[model samples]
Target: MKDDKQLEQTEKDKRQKAIIEMIQTGKYRRQSAIVDELINQDFTAVQGTVSRDMREMKIVEGKDGSSCITTEPLQDMHRNELQRLLRENHPPITKILLFTT
Candidate 1:
């Protein structure tokens, strides 16, 4: 049997995963929307919980004004490298492209 802390962590993990999925779907634009979707999916989520989850997940608004997860350290390194290359070889880069399916 799981302890209370363990159970709470499990639920938080599940909720955070759902948040990532909803954001990836490109249908949710705001934290309130995410909270609503979580409630619809039978997950208990409040504004404060969602906010904390997003912060822990390192989620950020993309250039296109969409929420995205920045948890990929490798991808971040590559992006930084690409930006450095562009800055050294060409003009100052204004935008970085993110391809999502």
Candidate 2:
């Protein structure tokens, strides 16, 4: 018989795997939707659990409004790199237009 801790871990692992599979389907656009699907699949999970799972799975939002699962989190390092690239490439805006006459 599996102990409580072991059982919990096993369940969590299973849920994580299922979450990945669901994301791969590309049918869910929101975390709540994922949770709903899990429920439909007979997996009892709350929104918080789904949200945490998404974070743990390194899920990111795509430009086309689709959710994508990545191997890395959107950490400060990536954010800093993006900021640096944007700053280096984009010109600074100097003029502010006043519409009031």
Candidate 3:
């Protein structure tokens, strides 16, 4: 048996991989129902968190059908809220750099 931390990391990796595969196969759109099924199939994670994980995986909501991970959206900074994040959490770069220097 693995230690708790190792087990956690393994689970995280598995969850991430599963999420990616599902998104690629056009499965991420199914939502809570599928998540519930995964949970029953021994995925020791919550459905709510799985939904959040989809966001972290860069899965985009589509109009025609389900969500999928798109590298284009990931690369296109203009289409995302990244700028708002920068504006909201613009840390003191000078202070950080001063410590490093």
Candidate 4:
């Protein structure tokens, strides 16, 4: 993680990782929880922001197939120091470049 002051918003890699970890850990679920966590860190993360972050992080629905968060490995997910990539649509990859690590 870089200096918190250097980050202008939650799009940052560190922030993204934190969001991923939070979702995986079940600390971020309902809108209010995410908002409260962000507020504690002086960031105003709204419900929409949380949703966008989840999407960007490629936070996937669990194997149970209900709308839930899961760290279940993406069959095609690839992660490097730069990013985590996922195939958002059929034929494997199209239209979306999400990050998840």
Candidate 5:
């Protein structure tokens, strides 16, 4: 049921996720290395796509000057923050209202 554009975007997202995991492992230190790994994994991506994905994801150099993918995608970052806020703050307020107040 997915259209061509939708399928293309899905594939792009999958490739980006795999890149992030590889970067996190510190094994793919260079863009070419990442591309090679992706190819090995059967993902058809080129260096340019990988470069764009890194830039879009806000991947940056670490303190040691190594490529790092520490920033989560904006959607993921927002979701995580929302979950953290709810987990840390919401339950206590509910408990106070139901049991103490």
Candidate 6:
């Protein structure tokens, strides 16, 4: 049972990696296209599966009105938000060092 679960996770990882590569190419404009491509590659896929992958991967449409989907913008957004929260909530480095010492 454990081995089966590991195999399933490995397959999911491969599929998501393929999805990332396809999205990076900026050719697939929609989830259906991604699903079709995955099918062509002999991987079992459906709209729901692709949609979940996109959501989990933080994929979003390009900001320039293009059909391309990418994770770059979402990554930047998350990075900036994290920085802001850290700036607001984190203690000073000196304080941290003093506590550790």
lDDT of 5 at 20: 78
Rank order by TM-score, top first?
5, 1, 2, 6, 3, 4
Over all chains combined, what TM-score does candidate 2 have? 0.63
Model 1 weakest lDDT span, ten residues long: 72-81
TM-score of 1: 0.66
How well does each candidate superpose onto the true structure, as a TM-score?
A: 0.66, 0.63, 0.55, 0.46, 0.68, 0.60
Query: Which candidate, 2 or 6, has the higher lDDT?
Result: 2
The parts of candidate 4 lying over 4 Å away from their true place are: 1-11, 61-101
Range of the 10 consecutive residues with the lowest summed lDDT in candidate 6:
65-74
Point to the candidate with the largest TM-score: 5
What does candidate 1's lDDT look like per residue over 7-72, in tens digits? 686677678778878887889989999999999999999999998888777888777777877767
22, model 6: CA deviation in Å? 0.4
Q: For model 1, what is the error of residue 22's alpha carbon versus the real structure, in angstroms, after optimal superposition?
A: 0.4
Residue ranges of candidate 2 with Cα displaced over 4 Å: 72-101
The digit string of per-residue lDDT tens for model 3 on 36-89 reads: 656766887677778777677677777876776777534533433464357457
Candidate 2 C-alpha lDDT tens digits along 13-85: 5677777777788888877888998899888899999888777767777888678867554353355457656
Off by more than 4 A, model 6: 62-101
State the number of backbone clashes in model 5.
0
Cα RMSD to native, each candidate? 16.5, 16.7, 9.9, 13.0, 8.4, 9.7
Task: Assess each prediction's global lDDT (C-alpha) against the native.
Answer: 0.79, 0.74, 0.63, 0.53, 0.77, 0.72
Better of 4 and 5 by lDDT: 5
The clash number for model 1 is 0
lDDT comparison, 3 vs 6, better candidate: 6
